[model samples]
Target: MVSVYKKILFASICIFALSCKSKKEEATKQNTTQQATLVDVIIAGTQQLSNTIEANGNVVANESLEIHPEVSGRLTYLNVPDGASVSAGTILAKINDADLQAQLSKSKSQLSLAEKTEERLRKLLAVNGINQADYDAALNSVNNIKADIQLLKAQIDKTVVKAPFAGVLGLRMVSPGAYITPQTILATLQETNKVKIDFTVPAIYADLIKRGATVSIINNNEPKRTAVIVATETEINTTTRNLKVRALLGGVPINPGAFVKVLIDAGKQINSIVIPTNAIIPDATSKKLIVVKNGKGTFVNVETGLRTSSGVEITKGIAVGDSVVVTGVLFVKPNAPVKIKSVKNLTELTKEQ
Candidate 1:
């Protein structure tokens, strides 16, 4: 009976040891399986980022001329119709110059007679037959006659109206046979091949913007067109604390005084890390993101720069070729084990591991 009791105790000990070892093995297996769960990661690369400023403005013609009569007379000839396309020096209107033309012809005849008299007097003086005073008087008379002819010619030229530049003419304010003063508006001419966009930017951005800076213009009635800065005001407005900028847009059809939106690039390009917008998680106090390091998920706070429609620029808290959790990031915790199944979504690299 003593030997039988000893045998039973040994059997009980062996069974207890086996049960404890099994429990330990089961716990180890559960931990390994939990660590093997897969998570999606995006490998991001560096990209050149451009900063831009958006502002609203209005479109103006590159050149505009207001046609006004230079002389006071009866408008006799109205040659150009309203909204007529004209080239430089195209005649638009003419004032009554019948009297002026007669006067000009008379002055030219007198000038010819004076020139003949002056020549005869000079020959007489050379032969010592005429007095010096007589020759001097003849020369003065010839010069005076020439002056009168020039005055008459100038007055005649003023009667015929001509276009100062090549452009489209506006409505004619005066009609034929209407008496027009110097203040009379004959028409308006505006060049429309290239348009200028005028806008004001904050004073802080004045230094960043300069002549030749590229801009994008979107007109209310036309499609978007690319332009460049043609001019910039050197002085900033004191009341508004803004600097004025003008951009010239060519090859695009736009009208004067039309409303437009201008977008200008503000700064130099910088290499920065960018990620999809959905990948970033905003915490209560700061912005955070999950990165896969050494097959483990790590949480990091990041500083962002420009925000675009597709992604946000990561200025800090990340580097190139870093695997970031783009999907299922909210479900991950710090120091969590993660399996990287792909890295192609974040960059141009092909999937290998």
Candidate 2:
């Protein structure tokens, strides 16, 4: 009986040891499977980045003119229609010049009579039939009459309106036969072959913007054509605390008053790592990023610099050629196992891409 009891105790001990070992093996297998369930990651390299600031602006003509009447009369003939294309010296409108014409005719008749009298006096003076004073009076009358005729002619010419410059005319403000004065507006003309985009930048960036500094302009209405900055205002606006900038657009026909977007480089180039804005993970303690190190996924805190629509500059906590999980970073944890499905090749990770 003693021997049987001893054997039973030995059998129970063996069974207990095997059961504990099985449990330990199962726990180990579960932990390994959990660690292997991490998602894949891809990486990018640091590169020199360019920063840009975007602003809203308006498209304007380089030269704009407001056409106004120079003579007080009824607007008679509008030779140029509304929105008409006109060249320099093109007749735009006409005012009633009957009064001016009548005055001119009277002056011409007086001038002709004065000339005849002067000629007769000259002949008489040469023959000693007239006094020198009388001949001088006749010549003075001719001169006065000629001046009167010239003044009348100038008035008449003022009644006819002509384009000051070659451009497209805006809507006509006065119609035919409308009573007009010198203050009356006839039309507006705008030169549109090369357009200007006007924008204001912050006063802090005034030093960076200079004359001939390159800029880009994007039209909200037409996104295809981009304008280049041609000029900048030398002085800053005191009231607005901003500096004025103008960009020239070539081959794009833009009308005055059209809105546009302006982009200007701050003139500082940096050699920092840039990544898409969405790749940044913001946390309360620090700005973090999911980076792939040693073929495993990890969380790394990073410092950021200038931000743009496409990406943000990584100032620290990331290195060149370090694979970062850009798309699926939200579902990852530090030191987790990951599968790298796609890696951005060196050629694809360059500055432009």
Top candidate (TM-score): 2
lDDT of 2 by residue, 1-353 (tens): 99999999999999999999999999998886676534434356565667677778988897898898788988888875788888999988889998888888888888889899999999999999999999999999999988888888888889998998888998888778899898998889988888888889888877767666667767665665666667777788989988888877777678889887777777567776777766678999899888877656778889987776547788889887777776567766678766666655333433434
Compute each candidate's TM-score over C-alphas.
Answer: 0.62, 0.63
The TM-score, computed over Cα atoms with residue i paired to residue i, of candidate 1 is: 0.62
Poorly placed runs, candidate 1 (over 4 Å): 1-50, 267-353
- The ten-residue window of minimal lDDT in model 1 covers 344-353
Best by lDDT: 1
Candidate 1, lDDT over the whole model = 0.83
Cα lDDT, model 1, residue 207: 80
lDDT of 1 by residue, 28-66 (tens): 878976865476777778777777677888889988988
